[model samples]
Target chain A: MMRITRDSLLSGNANRRSWMALVNPSASELTQAAATLDIPESFLRKRLEGEASRPLIKQERLISLQFQVPMPKKGGTGQFMLVPLSLYFVPGYFVTLSEQEIPFLSQLIDPQKPRKRWELVLRIIAEVTRNYLPTARSVAREMAVVERDLRQAQRHDVVYRGLDINDRLLTLDLGLLQLEYVVSEIGHFLPAEDAVLAEIHEDTRIELSQVRDQVDSDQATINELLESYAYVVHNNVNHLFKFMAALIILATIPLFIPGAVAMNVPLGNFPHWHYGFTVVTGGLVLVEMLTAWVFYRKGWLRLD
Target chain B: MGCQFYDTVEDVWVATERYTADGLFLLMPEQVHQCPQLEAALQRCLEQRLYCQDAEITLRLPVALLAQDAQFGTVGRMTHLTLHHTPRSLAILGEEPLIRRLQQNWLGELRHTSMGELLQRVLLSIIYSHERVARVLVERLQVLRMALKTAMGNTELRQIVALNRDLGELVIALRETGLILRNALRATPGESPVYPLLDAALREQRRIEDGVNLIHERYLAVTNAYNGIVQNNAHTVMKVMTVWLALLMMPIAFIMPWHMMTPLPLEHWHYLWFGLLAYVFGVTLLFARWARKHGFFSM
Candidate 1:
């Protein structure tokens, strides 16, 4: 709900403690921002596009991080976006740059709960980790819903929804994989040379590792259930195939008898007789009945 | 040769090979030291000429023949290995090969020969109250793989797939290990598929067969049921269609020849005969079709 513009982020009010900035940077602005900051142009470009950033890299006292933050719970589609955040710790000041507004900063800047910048980053990562479980559960529930629709044979709408669910599941799986990959990269920065930094980094490492593990576990569970559902879909397709095949084979039987009769292989001059045509017709009727009865017994037809 | 049984553990059969210098004693776990019965059984294997010749040097001899008192705890279960001894080195060459060949040949006769042999061996070790029996079984990895295969999957198809993959791994591992064991023993004491291992192989084979049967039955029943339902519906449809055509076509026959005969025998009558007949035939045909469509007499 909070929409922060570029003007708000650059607002020159020293007194204001907290603010939200939505920075929908155009391609040129992003390029210019990278030029002014002297960072690689790809840094901002990459994060802005993907669901999550690849990993954090530190060069020349500047740390650039990419994160895939989950949208709000009520956010339609439950998608996450890739946002690249770069931090500069140049002696006098610190700066955060992102293509979009960062919500975590607002929580840190809240008047009642003032937090140091270092504490805020840890808090942000922790909150992101905790939120993954619920988001994953929602995806699982969505899959179950699709599975139920399949069971009910609701092919009309669910065919599309099933496709959507499959796509969503792929998206979620990729997002989690990227998140874990980034966390593992960040983990390498731990065992800090400085004591305080080490303590903080180690604790964060454990938290992130646990989150990575939990997400991986959930990913596996979702995949297994999806495989089972795949089998169900396969079974349904086979059922439909059997039905169609039976119908085709059944309908073909009547055609064969008519074809033989039309061949006009003489049946004792019955065709020339006045009402002898009735006998031929009667024979045709008898043939159809007998063929149908055989078909019925052979289980090509179902009265039940 | 006479068979001598040194019944140490209740379910276990132990044979001790005789040493020419002094009788060799098979060392058991420390817990058995407390059980006077197992101690007495160990003495019986040494005293009676019951030990196989190859068993003499291979059996782990105690710290001292008299045995000092020590508290012992075990890391895991123990698998009882048969040891053989011979009076001379020549006796060994002849006896060991015969023992090896006998064990190897017996495997072919055993009704089942997969993990059943391994399971039976493990179970026997457990029933004999051998220490580290579970660990010994676990070390093989094949048993655990087979157990996991059986443990998972609810539906017959899923279970069959799971079990097949597991059993495939198990069989491959066993074959590879058997080759490794044979190569290792070719230089020394030698190896064979003894009775116990053969028994376990049979047990696992049975499990595989059961899984296969379950999957077959499940597939057959579902297909049969589905076919029955579809067939019955089609028969009812065909019967009604046949009856419909017969009723509808009956009226066209009665009017066809009567109209044609009356108009013939004159030049105009010749054309009129064919033409009138055709007109009546067309009208009758249309009426019959309409009746058939409305189901006036169909079925």
Candidate 2:
């Protein structure tokens, strides 16, 4: 049997209301809980079993929101991922189902602190949004490292790291965008159900916007960095091609004049003279040198 | 199954079985029942309920890097190592090079230290050396990056290829070895100072992995750039040779035929034609031979 604790997690400061936390329940347990609550089992089960959906409310009296909270990958590898925290609102009370432990939930929803449903959610969202900062800020830090790597001694490794940061920021960017939509929807659905929640939600909104702004800026910077590096690679290849083209032109010009004159124009008696071959070959070389000098002075062959 | 007994009192490796069970030992994989001590440690571990005999949990790792089994069976092919501590003695097994490396780097003097302290040193020695190798590889890649700024020779190009292969292998080995180490280390208590050391080692391993991956990325760009350089240089030289050769031959083509048809400059025109014909034939044959040798055409 699923134990239902009706003790008020929010009381005195919040209205005289209660919420239940379902910590890792089975299908039968869920059904049992739904039977006790007199709510449809399928509504709760859809959230429990279905993959994470955007935070939204169903119109059939029961309001539900699936908020994803960032949880660290176990063993503390300095990496984290978003896991769902499902909340079901039925009239005056709410029930939560979580896939991961909320370490700060007990402290955040303390009876001493006192909170209404919307106030509780505002605090929860604020806390969960705060969890995103470490990973989000780590991206900014990694971005700086990458920028430094790119600027300094060519960090062949940062190229790989830059790609990782690019991917990480892109993922965070998508998650935050979805969350922004969800946060706004929650505000719309619940409205200022609690004056305290509205007041607290303002604080959460500022923090959210700050994180969102950082993510957006990081995403843009990563895109620009990747593009600039691509352009660098392209420019290197193009520079080589230009050098080759110039060398070909240099060779071609010197070769062409002799080729055109070799059409057996009158050599006069030059072929009969002892110095004939020398004079003609020397004259051709002199013309070639002059062509080379002119091309060199023109700076068409130079590259940065 | 290379086994070396470290006589703790003497502070040196010895072949004799004279050392007590309290002495330290260096060991590799056993040949079934070769070392009763391993069997004892294994049984003691099983008795201690250190970890379930078969329970396995997947540690989320970057799938692109490794997809290795984490069940903690000695895994480095022939070079995998494990440290075993019996009631009376300690031993490290697997990876002959690592075993040899450990033996070479052994701290001299007393061996009356606690098992935990000795084990800490042994594990640190392994990880520290591993991290050093990664650092050296990174330096070599740095040198290569600088070299790539200029034109590359066959030697430098070959070095990059070698570095690419080495870094790729290191990346795989580091992760696999890291996984094995984690699985092995977790068998011990969480509060052991070794746990913090393992964490540090893990952090270093990640840094090294990131560095290796970045260096490996460079391989593709450098290879492409260098290949372009070689091809472009070859193409330019070939173009110049072909253009000049064709041009130089233009006068010969016209002069040889025209002068032969009607030339009143000298007698012995037959000798001139005969010698010139021989020369032209030799040049044609030589050019054909040169082209064929250079793979422009078959002989």
Candidate 3:
């Protein structure tokens, strides 16, 4: 539970973060219905009446930065989503506005007097994004399983899982892009001479950059998995069709022999001869066996 | 009431009282925790656990006072000592009882010669406190390992989950404290009276951090390897069932159509039903062999 001026450095283990703030139950602590800023009032509304994905907007004396941080989907979906968390430095107070309380905000330096607000902000951004690393590792494990028994991916249940992964990966990528943009802009507000703050800034930048690279790598792996998944499914269906075609052709060729025997213009008296039906039937069975053997030898009878 | 120093000449803790007037003061402000205004400002800090594990040193600048704070204590006790250094004086603020105890227990290891060396020893004591906790964590890990060997229910699994959470917190605390000590090492001047002391503090932090990390890695390995064996056994059973059903499907596919139409020789014979049954088994055997040869029906 030890926190410091550099919570970001301490957040190296994003799993055990201390989140005792637990999200205020009242929830409307930052209800700014009427502020003195020239910007749109909708921006201050709790509903966040403007663009949901806005990265940062500094207008006059108010600087508001909005970012999408990843969170697990509710209802035990086993899927992750990007939720918007907005930080506003308006007048004397630094308020963060999120639909639900993100645990990362608890690590912010005393919000009432955040003399080190920039450090906390950068750290929060870095920590929330870095949390995705563990999730990504799990996702890679899932991808490995799907890759091995890829034919099973075509099942109704597993099919949607692939889509869910794709959705989660895209959401992560979008969140990271906003973070990348926000951190670059955050550098301008840093006090020029404080070596400690500079060091923190550099660390945050490196952490975010690494996360971005990881997202890219994960994105590539998933895309490759999906492509292989498609090819396996496609090849299975095509092979099944080929095997059915061979079955049909083998079944049909023997029927022509019986048809030939019943021809009206047969001069050989095949129909009039004794035991003519048995000979024609026996010849038909022979033709069917030969055709099936040919198809099996050609490997067209196998769908596996 | 401050500035108790370890006297090099007398080889004792000296209560000279002159160092207080000399602008070097160790100020323990228990009242800061009580102040209403400061309470709101310290809310973020108060949200952390009462026990102090992560230590951070901040220098209040030329434009501001440089404050370096570290905490030292055992259970039911802790002190958040902030070393606020300014040109006028240096103040150490925290709970008074701990401050008094460090002075009372002093064995002339600290110095008034340089505040850096004193601060270094203060941090070394904090890191030293964690060694006991690490020992407890490692012992619990061993228990969890033994429990998993004869694991009959979810009891050991829950214990593992709980132990992992504890390991994670300890790791974060150790690493953060290590980084703080490392920073102290970098910032202290080699020619200064505190450099070697700072180095010793960093070394102590590293030893603890590395030791805790070894435990963490062992915990992870134990849990992961256990989970893998469980999963692999489960998968093997599932694979065997799936292969059995899949192998039956091949025979079923080829025989069902033939059974629907084909007329066997001596159709009225009493053994005719046996022939059909034998045919089904014969085809199944051949397909199973083929599957085995193709490496498709591995157990």
> Which run of 10 residues does model 3 chain A get worst, by summed lDDT?
A1-10
Query: Between candidates 1 and 2, which one is better according to lDDT?
Result: 2
Candidate 3: the clashing residue pairs are B27-B92, B59-B66, B60-B65, B60-B66, B60-B67
Docking class of 3: incorrect
DockQ of the candidate models in sequence = 0.01, 0.01, 0.01
lDDT of 3 by residue, A1-304 (tens): 1122222222212221221221222323223222322334556563353332235656567677877777776654346666677776544345555656677565555433333556667778778767766666555566655566655322222333554565466556656666776887788877788688788888888888887688668766665555445456445444544654665565455435655654456436544465655565677677778888888888888857
**For all the models shown, what interface RMSD does each have?**
15.6, 11.9, 14.8
Displacement of the residue B11 alpha carbon in candidate 3, Å:
82
Q: By lDDT, highest first, what's the ranking?
A: 2, 3, 1
Worst 10 residues of 2 chain A by lDDT: A150-159
Per-residue error for A20 in candidate 3, Å, reads 14
TM-score top scorer? 3
DockQ of 1: 0.01
Every model's TM-score: 0.38, 0.38, 0.43
Off by over 4 Å in 3: A1-41, A50-54, A75-78, A107-115, A137-149, A152-164, A224-228, A264-282, B1-299
The candidate scoring highest on lDDT is 2
Scored by lDDT, model 3 comes in at 0.52
